[model samples]
Target: MTKVTAQLSVSLDGFYAGPRHDGDGDWMASAESHGFFRVTRWVTEAMSWRERQGFAGGRQDVNSEIVAESFDAAGAYVMGRRMADGGEVPWGDEPPFRAPVFVVTHRPRERLVRQGGTSFTYVTDGVESAVAQARAAAGGKDVAVAGGGSLVRQVLRAGLLDELELHVVPVVLGTGMRLFDADLGLDEFEGIELTPTRVVPDPQVTHLRYTVHDRTPLTLDDRGAGTEKA
Candidate 1:
């Protein structure tokens, strides 16, 4: 059984993307504040690899530590169409995964073969099907959910997430997409807050780690204490 984890970079105001995300998303979002650029460069650099096949964005100390911690743990990645640009991936065509990647999309398309050892497999049957495919491809490591809002919402709603690693960029765009855009709510797990790291330029970017817990409510005894029954 593989753990399903969501790693996202959000602003201090709790938004992943800022303003209008036209093709100029990165450039415009970066100009919003020094923290934004710091986080962006950090995230981009975190995914960069020596093979030049994965996302080769600029590097950052914070992102390097965080990404290096998680990227290698997964056997496959599940992403939304918006994040499918050639760069965000680690390997599409050799070394990183050499495994299948399931992408959720409304439009249908053939598999994409990239320079790296990665391939994009488009899926439209919905989140359940995508997760199934990802689990099957993942073998036993983990399934990483690359976000675009809707996919994360779906996975969260389905109660399929095992952990979440969020990076707070420390800037407020006043508008844009969000990480938790779900329509429902449930106390599915008790999350333990991990260490928080600050980023460069403005020193506002923060990264938080949490582990997922799924357990049934405990039964109390008549004396208002936990029951000791087998």
Candidate 2:
């Protein structure tokens, strides 16, 4: 059976992005982060996959190896409107994802074809519909959800994710869009079950893989107890 997977980079402080600044230099909501580039620098700075996507230069080291695994055999992708937005940076003519990508948005649009075998199909219904479309497109391969926090939350909360690969960076973003936000909270004390599958350690960051299962009550310390042994 093909599993539904998601890959994300989180900070030591559990943030998916760095803090943001308002026009008047006042603090905005936690969701108002600068961007994920700074937080995900460990992977972006030394990833071979990035270079393969037409990026200039990056170290082809352990970090690169970890990053490469995500793009190896995924059949399709799903992302949120925010993730697809050009507010931060546009993905350029050709994105790293060379397969079909379903973008979840309220605003409907026609299919967008890009260079290098990548095509974006706008999905207006919801996450489940997008995942269903992605699964149909995958054809026995895994459905990889490239998230920006909120979408991943919906997928996980709806029990649609099968695996989660988290690359925990060493840096701390004091205030930002957190990967584990309270809005997606479960019943008090209810916990999401995660069985450690793999751990890839690097000097800059640590890649952890987990097989996600039904929700139960478990502490974060209990779930992640022995996962860092890489």
Candidate 3:
């Protein structure tokens, strides 16, 4: 079985992309050490999807372990069009992702092939279809929801996501895309559980994991241990 999980970095203010994201780079641009490019490169190299997608070298810096662990069991990846460079830059020399990369978009484009083992597969259909295809490609491994926020929101809104892994960067951009900014009624999710995690710097930046219980509502005794119901 394949699981769908949304994983991304967020700021203290709960924003993923800043107001100037359109003009500037990404939301993490204003933070120290950024970890923007670093994270992207790390994610690509981390996935089992990388075997067929694309990858670039010159990385292997800090945070490699966590990056590697993310996809140690991942089978494939999916993301919104914005996450696909917004169809801008042609994913040139060192492209980031390396799985059976599925891009959700209404626009039509030819299949994209890149360096270091990667190819782009565009899906015009909705999230469910993408999840199905991703699972097929994942080969029993987990499916990761790559995001620029919109895509993750769409899946979450539809109650399609089963998990969420967040890596928080301690910064107060005050304005940017947020992981859960748009109201996604909590009721839609059953057995919603959250686990708090901290790294060397504690709150400076932390990694959290959320798991959704089966769709049906459950009683208190039905809740699993180590899960802080949301």
- lDDT tens digits, residues 114-159, model 1? 5544678999888888888888888798898877666787787677
- Candidate 2 ranges with C-alpha deviation above 4 Å: 20-35, 87-89, 217-230
**Clash counts for all predictions:** 7, 1, 13
Residue pairs in steric clash, candidate 2? 191-216
- Give the local distance difference test score of model 1: 0.65
Sort every candidate by lDDT, greatest first: 2, 1, 3
Q: State TM-scores per candidate.
A: 0.68, 0.85, 0.69
Ten-residue region with minimum lDDT total, candidate 3: 32-41
Measured by TM-score, the strongest candidate is 2
Give Cα distance to truth, residue 202, candidate 3, Å. 5.2
Q: Best-fitting candidate, measured by lDDT? A: 2
RMSD of each: 7.2, 6.4, 7.3
Taking all chains together, the TM-score of candidate 3 against the true structure is 0.69
Model 2 C-alpha lDDT per residue in residues 7-98, reported as the tens digit of each score: 89888888887654436452333335444665678766865766866778888888887777777768899988867764224577888788
Per-residue lDDT of model 3, residues 1-230, tens digit only: 78888788777666665552455555455542243433343345533334323544433433445666665656788888876865337466445455677788898788787765456778887778887888889878788888867788778767788888777666666654567754555554454444443433433346666775434554457457778778
lDDT comparison, 1 vs 2, better candidate: 2
After TM-score superposition, what is the CA distance of residue 28 in candidate 1 from its true location, in Å?
A: 6.5
Candidate 1 — worst ten consecutive residues by lDDT sum?
190-199
